[model samples]
Target: MRSYLFVPGDRPERFGKALAAGADVVILDLEDAVAAPNKAQARDNVRRAVDDGAQVMLRINGAGSQDFIDDLALLHGLPLRGVMLPKAESVGPLGELAEVTDAPVIPLIESALGLWEVMTVARGPGVERLAFGSIDFQVDLGCDGSDEALLHARSRIVLASRVAGLQAPVDGVSVALDDEAVIAAESRRSRALGFAGKLCIHPRQVAVVNAAFSPTREELEWAARVVAACERSAGAAVSVDGAMVDLPVLLRAQNLLAMAG
Candidate 1:
């Protein structure tokens, strides 16, 4: 899934529009996006969406919170693609997840403690991937949300996910609602940092994020050529397009093609 678009759980009216926005997955958010007064209503809306059989995921509130407890009740016997737990910092809370649902859990690493304890969180039971909550992370660190400022944090999350044998982490949203250039650049930056997907706040951001994450035509062509060379060479060394096609290079090419598909 290249793009995970979030729609507020309370806004059931927008759920279908979000679903049709070309996102790989639509997340009905119960956290951050919902206000205290509307949480109950949001839960009801999410339940109706489930009853109507929307294929989606849910972003529950932070672990150990009262809302988190209520959010778990909403998951019972529903058909969901996955669950995203925000403000994740420990696996102990995650252990409770096993009793409720078997769906994949994505831990949103958003704070200094969450980043520090990410490896353990990645290795937590039922965790399928890690997600970088970049905005909240910046707020927690009191740092500017620049590529340079967040480089170390992003790299650490990527490494932890890899070491824990989970899927590549998902990056946070780009707040630029109208600037496709800025949005596309941010999505590309996420890919360059080893993220497999990105969290999207707006439906309009979906197309740009999808395009940025997808392998370009030139990349696909090169990958195809390298794959052909690798197959023909079998166990022998080879060159493709004047570039040496070693094991690593060949593997990279094959992976690129698979991703493009």
Candidate 2:
């Protein structure tokens, strides 16, 4: 999945619109997006949508919150695509959540404690992927939102996800809704750092995020050439554009081609 778009659960009118927004996954948000007084109503709306055959992922409240239990209760026996656990700080709570539903869990690492324990969380049972909550992470660490400031944290998430054998982590949202250039640059940077997807706040960001994560035409051609050369060489070392094509390089080219498809 290249783009995961968020739609407020309380806004039932927007649910179908979100599903039609061309995102790979639509996350019906029940956590931060819903107010306290409307939490129950939002849960009911999401349940009804699922019963109506709308496929979507749910973003539940944090583990320690009272709403967490109620959120799980709403999901009982429903056919959900997945669940996103906000402010995920440990594997214990994640394991407890797994016991409630068979859907794969996606832990959003936002706090310092959560970032430190990310490896354990990624390796936890039924974890489908990891997602970075960059805005919350900056708040927790009291740092700026510049790439330099978040590089360490971002790198750590990528390393943990790779080490745990999960899909590459999803980068956090780019808040500048009007600037497609910023969104594209950040998406490219995230992809370069081994992130397979990004969290999109608006439907407008989806196309740019998907394009950034996908292999370019030049990249696809290069990959195809390298793959053909490697196949002809029969595992022997070959040179592609003055660079020696070995096992790792050949595998990378093949992976690029597969991603393109």
For residue 78, model 2's alpha carbon misses the true position, in angstroms, by 1.6
lDDT of 1 by residue, 1-261 (tens): 899999999888899999999999999999999999999999999888888889999999887788988888887787789999999999987888877889999999999999999999999999999999999999999999999999999999999999999999999988998899999999898899899889999989999999999999999999999988888988798998898888889889989999977
What lDDT is reached at residue 213 by model 1? 91
- Residue 9 accuracy (lDDT) in model 1: 93
List model 2 lDDT by residue over 1-261, tens digit each: 899999999999999888998899999999999999999999999989999999999999998779998988887887888999999888887878777889988999999999999998999988999999999999999999999999998999999999999988999999989899999999999999989999999989999999999999999899999999988999777998998988888888898899977
**What local distance difference test score does each model get?**
0.92, 0.92
What does the lDDT come to for candidate 1?
0.92
Q: How many collisions between residues are there in candidate 1?
A: 0
Model 1 pairs whose backbones collide:
none
* Model 2 segments more than 4 A misplaced: none
Query: How far out, in Å, is residue 23 in model 2?
Result: 0.8
> How far is 252's C-alpha from truth in model 1 (Å)?
0.8
lDDT of 2: 0.92
What's the residue-level lDDT of 87 in candidate 1? Answer: 92
